[model samples]
Target chain A: MSTTTRMTGRRIVAIAAVALFILHQDFWFWESTALVFGFLPIGLAYHALYSILAAGLWAAAVKFAWPDHIERFAEAGEPEGGESSGGSVRS
Target chain B: MTPMVIVLCYLALLLGLGIASNRFFRGTSRDFFVASQSIGSFMLLMAVFGTTMTAFALVGSTGKAYVRGIGVYGLMASASGLIHAAVFFLIGIRLWSFGKRYGYVSQIQFFRDRFGSSRFGYFLFPILVGLVIPYLLIGVLGAGKVISPISEGRVPPWLAGLVVCAVVLVYIFAGGSRGATWANTFQTLVFMVMGVVAFSLIASKLGGLQAATQQTDPAYLSRAVQNVEIQTREGTLIREVGVPPLMFLTYFFVPLSVGMFPHLFQHWLTAKSARSFKLMVIAHPICIMIVWVPCVLIGVWATGVKEIPPLAEAEAGKVLAMMVNLLVHDEFVTGLLTAGILAAIMSSLDSQFLCLGTIFTNDIVLHVAGRERFSDRQIVWIARGFIIAIVAVTYVISLVAPKNIFDLAVWCFSGFASLFPLVFAALYWKRATVWGAYASVASAMLVWFYFFHLSEYGHEYALWGGVMPVTFCFLAGAGAMVLVSLLTRPPSPAAIEKFFPQQLEIDQ
Candidate 1:
């Protein structure tokens, strides 16, 4: 893969690992089968992964719901120096 | 010197540092406010963490844990910390990347740039400033209340608070974020050390971590799996507060959205690079866990130890002070720990003061005055003046405000929640019309005022179990964004390309 893609991939992995560490308890879950199924519905899984997944779903919903609008907004040209094109231009 | 003397001396040293840091101020308005965008990731990271762990966490969280049990400790302290980390991951990195690339300077700028709405900036500005004033006042009053008893009432709580605010304003006004960044690092380190020492002392007194934790009531430890009934003072069963574990998965998004808070956005904006931003985000969950769990556990332990008075009888923000007094009778250590708590309070208050002042100067004042560029010297002075003014206003409010910290905090969040959805839509949805944004903010605030704030109707949304109003506010904003944008002529292609270049491929 290209350098930019590789960087992006690394970022995703790093983010995922950090998310897991934050939400999930390695010590709590590694030994306890009861925890895995018990917390799944509440998405607690007592793990950071649950928290990360919830957030990811919310963000994805937002992105998917407004793909067209997002594209249009992105296509909006850059504001000229000292001029705001999005609204009334200030002198 | 005695503990009080030590604390006073620490306060003086902080003031001196604030004054010293002022030398770095480059006489620019932006420099005085945001340090002219010179802050790097480390400073930004420290500032983010330091500014967020407010008086509430220091005192109220402990008090809550003391009263409610370990479940309160986990929910208020650990959950908040973990959720905060979640926010950083989902939104913080993107906000930082966008702000740096777009030259976004203020929360208003972000809302405006993302939504292309001058009106949205104008609308949200007042609401932000309004919410921020009470929020800052809580910090001041909270610190003051804690310090007063510690000083044997020698330094009145209000005066102690005023002094802390004055010292913060001095450094913040002079050095801007530059001063806040370095000062916050020291402040955070002090808090971390004091926290660990205090936690260890408390844990040991309770017969070590495992023993103490095991002693906690089963219900307190079971919030993850159990649903408990909440009761009113009259013994009436209030509606259940906790959703099922499955429902909590969805409800978890509420606090996590705090990453979208304006102050958090500013931290993201100041990071040196996207990598630095990511590192900070990744590190946050660990940092939060280390600090929060011990405090919550301490709170849970306090509940079993003795009979603390009910909430009304006790000073609202003195729970930590009581715990410290009970645990550590050593005068010097007490003073140092008191100073550490003060550091946490001041660090949070200072960053907020800077943020509020900057928003007023950059978003409201500049917009209202219809002038953007002035000499850097004038801007710096004006910005400082705004800081002083904001502090004074908040002081008066805190002095006279009738409600307790929790009530006030909820109110503050209500104000921001009204506006948060609009900004969220603007970023993610291209069709988010300015009119829709305005309507959502206006209607939500209006509903909040009438139902939650104003005339006491028996049927209030916040008090009652109606999720509909909040859900409606969120949906109304999103709906307005879609319906209005679709109905109106699409933004000019040049404007679209300028405002949102990533969307250019849609032309095909």
Candidate 2:
């Protein structure tokens, strides 16, 4: 993919992840009459699945939108031992 | 052996572990507070997860699930898994960077420097301490609930509270942050294992998951609110099925409090590197699942079990302990499960106690009296003194037997959630001003007080017509922050540059 396309894709993924998180909070699915595997409450099961998806989305967020400065901080060795403030800023 | 003896032995083992951790203490205030920032990933994960679990997640959550049904898991647990990890990734990493670069040991230090006013610490110190005291009460109250019941009426609630407070104080005073981290890690493992064990034993004793769940009221299995009719001494009355949909939806904001927790902020600074956070982000949700799934299920099972009498609303907090005692039957297992629940409660208590002490000593005293006047040894002593005083105050308050553990926790978490806007803006928005910070704090607290008073007066207290109190409080804080900051002066270029150095070129 081109640089612009990749950036656009990343933005779409980030936005989608955020939207999913917000929508997951709403109880539209609470109206569902279905039960999970005939035992667990459907609402309870939905959230359990929702939680796993949330974890995956956050993983994507780390992969794509992980702040460059944080990566630099990681590469720079022990954060506590370092004193160079300017090292956190990239040109 | 009796359950009481086993519990006493468990307490003794904790004290032993606390003293053992002291051998690694380096005798510096830095080592005392942040453990010299040498904590690795697994320890960091365990410590952070343990501190967040608290009695709120174990005792309070199980009780809440009993009252509210399966919907209880969705209200906080499931959402928390994601929201907490997001907070860790977004807020925690940035704060860790700032803390490392600027040598900040507490949240108040960051706010003081960011707002360009040392006086801001004065305004913040008491508010943060007041908020934390309620959070501390959750643990103390929970410890009392777990211990008092298992030991029967022989041990009063106040005695249980005293034992928990004294045990935590000994470890924290001796080993400081390092000791708390080690204890929290050990406690986290103990509680997670015991939680699953208790769930399995109880479920089997109640004739397996399918049969147990089948025994519960059908309305209890659904999110759709229904009028559950029950026959009581006062005659038949109706109870609501589960949490209202809107209230359940708005609970997503409560976990956002993790961003502004002074205790968690201190934990963030203990990371050896930003890389240390990677494990926390990935594993936090998974770990939350491990702990909460069993608690919620067991709580749901309690509704169906016929062995114990139906729990009155007021007696909901004892559901978990009652389940273990009635179902397990063995003194050893019951004592072990009680210890595990207490482990979860004490893990958070030690951290909160240590954080309050660190804040009082570093933010209030050292900042006001001047650090040069106090010796390093004196500083540690000052922190220890404040912790002891706070523990005494919390223990005394727990004796009064105030609000339900879960209800009190929601109010406490709400206060922290309302303040989330202040910290987020301070870090991410250059236009964020000291005036805006002031306005945000004032607005959030005022709204919180109004709702709190309404709750006391028996009002449902939803804001903006059925929206949760946290929604309005967060908006009031964020809205005041943005509008007041724009109308007022932006932070100085120098102040902005400190936080956002790369933006200096763009601004120029």
Candidate 3:
């Protein structure tokens, strides 16, 4: 992932998340008595698909929005002058 | 008899898993409370997701869907899918980083350190435990209600509640949260698979999913509440009712409560690496869909099923169990479905029992008595004793628990959602102060109680003009935190440097 693409992906995912939230209300389907696949209500089906999109968006968040700096802090061991590692025995 | 045996076996398996996991226990408070921080991505997802779900996901959602229609899914599941992940990504990772960095065991520790006030822990501890007791009752009471009907009354609700509590305590006592996570992982998988199987068999029995749904009134299937005018003896009136749009929109805040759940914070700390959060962040929404869509659908379908009895307002929680019993008559499958329901309930119970114990031992007992006074072994014992006491108290209350599981859960969740603002600001806003946090909590509690006192819990309760109390409680909390934080002197720079370092983009 190039830096520009990574940044763009993050922006796109954020926009998509906001769109998903807005679409979630589904007021149009609120009164419609339609069924999809003859088994699921149109409203219910819309939300199920919305849930999948959300999962995808969160995956995008992990890929793009993950804070490597914070991870580096942990991997780099305790910072100098940090409090004495509290009272814990890490395996 | 067969179904009852299966439920017993299910409980036994959980107990066995916990006892077996205890063999790996390191005999230290760290290991007992947080699995020595060794959990990886898959187990982290299971534990976090499992704890987030409770009787609320299965029995309560099903029950609520029965009364409220398919909108129940919209009101909670879909919004929860988005909001919960947002919180996990935005808050969970940051908290995990802080917990690992500071070796913090409980949420109170993080808040206490962030605000530089030990008094905050004392304030926050009782509220967290107070709210969690109702959460625990949701499971215990849900279990009692769930098991009796599914087993044809061979096992009464009180006995079922006892067995469920006993089993959870046994596993929690032996395994601590580490054991609880392992058991949660197993139980989570069990419930998910069982949820699908039950949904399939019951739908197959009731003609088909679409056919079962279409059999009900269109009004039941519709999520819209529209205006209808009527004439009375004295006057004419217009009414707009069903599911209020404002109520639906405000429900979006209820799931935000997860960001502040103490048990979830404990699970977050268990992550072995920051990367472990990646899988959890991705899979949680999909997992929620898999569990909720069917349960809600089954609940709606129960309305059309001819064999099922009419569930009164108070008897709503029993609707799911009644469907399983009346429709899936094969004893063996009923047993499995019952185990699945119990799985969802108990997975959450073990974690809650373990978490409350963690809070009492680490936050209250040790902080006040001084860690210097007790050995690590003694601390673990103190935790165990306190956990057993809480479990007994929660179970006794479950005996006379209210009729509607969903309503009870909503009230409990509203209380936690009130604290969501305080935790959010503490993590993200460096300016948040100790006194600001105090005001935020005070206002949040006052507003939450103001609304709660107004509610009879007799009908589905909402605030002015059909909005949920959570929306107001959350606002009051956030408004107070930001206003007071600005007015008060800012946090010590040292606190800022500790929580935020080098302008990390995530923090920014």
Candidate 4:
């Protein structure tokens, strides 16, 4: 396979790993913790999670969403007739 | 003079600047809305710093650390800053690059242009502006409340909020980003001085950090995994703490969506250079440290106080207010500090209000009205009017919302989180289509609101704590976006060529 396909495969695998981690947390951290340790530590852990996640989510949004806008936004600099409004249009 | 007088003098200074900056405003819509794209690194730093660190940092976060002990010092105060620094590294540089390339004015403009779909603009702008306005209003209401009591009821809360709103609107309207930058520079100095005075005095009184820690329990200083779960208001449950490895992964992936927020992107679009952005990335970590550490310490310090301020039990945000009131006995310092806090509040409020105004006027209004090339005079008034209206609405929402500051803050940014997937794809994935963006945002919001907000209020699940709502939203939304975009045909090469010429060039 080409280098492009290799990178895509790597990204997909990385995404899968993340998906597994989050799913595991939902089970182990949220469910298993309460069963073993009393609720206080679990509550504290959840509160920490809430705060971190809020900020984390926003940062994630930025990383994922910004490049597309940058590329799309770059269209305005293009010479006319190459593209409509100097943006990508699928034929 | 008393702190109150110092405060009044500060307010007078800000008002004078507002009036004075108008001459330099150039009366153009773009200038009024975005400071004519001439915002430098210093101005941008002040604007971002002054706005992001607000009454929340001053009172709320510290108060939390005080009550919760030192756990907050480690997690909320320190970690948040560290994470924000990380965010700047991952996303800030890219955002600045786009902002320069597009001459983009608002977050919505970036979104609309990126998706190459005007429809996405219509969907995204309202939700973003809506979320931001209430958050801004809440800041105003809280500041007003803090100021009124600090003045010994000499100033009314509603009046204070109104006065703040009016002053902010005038300056923001008059000079736009320039006004925000100049005002923020003045404001940041005031806040830092007040912070130093207040923290120093409190530390001395409490026999310094070691004694204060002992008094408040040394456990606060320990970064152990103990007591992570506790009984909340609703019932016994696990407390959400720790940067779970899962969340750390999300952090790596999630900043991928930074392009989605209109206000955040405005910062991007207004950068002087990619180098300036890079500098901001390097410097911002230290800046976050300077700002958050003292505030958290103050909070932890407040916990040791024998006599607490009233109403702190009901709300955490008011803890800082009570701390300020409890600690400061002298009138002069109080007035100066009050002015500083006002500066902090206005710093955030003015920037947010301007952001909201630009989003509405530029993206929502102009797009819907189907107009182009509006007169400079018309644009300025419209932008100002939108700001005033948004502030008013937010003020009312803050009064009536009945949510805790922490809860509200997290919720306000929920859309950004939920929409992260769609945004990431648009940026990095060449095949990401417009429908994918819309679908991802919708799916994430639906799941988030259902599980986190509505489910809790509706009392749907007391025992079912196995699933993390955020994780669920991330997977569901992100999965949907990729799948949907893949299923759909890609955009025309011609359209892609016009809009994404750089990507094409880079590819070449």
Models 1 onward score TM values of: 0.79, 0.92, 0.93, 0.77
List, residue by residue over A21-55, the lDDT tens digit for candidate 1. Answer: 34533333332223223212122224334434534
lDDT tens string, model 1, B1-508? 3778888898777777777877876665545555655676677667788877776556665655554443343343445545675456545655544454555557777767655657678778777776677778778887777678777888887788788887887778667877877688778777777877888876676667666655544343334333344333445432222222332232333353364466666656556554454445545555555555566656655544553333321342455566667766677878887887888888778878878777776676665666445554665666678888988888877777654554466455545555556656655555666666676677667765654544242222332332323444445555655676677766556545544465322222
Cα shift from native, residue B329, model 2 (Å): 1.7
Q: Write down the lDDT of every candidate, Cα atoms only.
A: 0.58, 0.80, 0.82, 0.59
* lDDT tens digits by residue: candidate 3, A13-64: 8898988889988888888768889978887888889889889889888887
Q: In angstroms, how far off is B420's CA in candidate 1?
A: 2.8
Candidate 3, residue B489: the lDDT equals 97
| Candidate 2 overall lDDT versus native | 0.80
Pitting candidate 1 against candidate 4, the one with the higher lDDT is 4
Single out the weakest 10-residue window by summed lDDT for candidate 1 chain B: B238-247
Best by TM-score: 3
- Report interface Cα RMSD per prediction: 8.6, 6.8, 5.2, 9.7
Docking outcome class, model 3: acceptable
Higher-DockQ candidate of 1 and 4: 1
Tell me, what's the RMSD of every candidate?
Answer: 6.5, 3.9, 4.1, 7.6
Ranking by DockQ: 3, 2, 1, 4
**Candidate 4 interface RMSD to the true structure:** 9.7
Model 3 pairs whose backbones collide: A39-B210
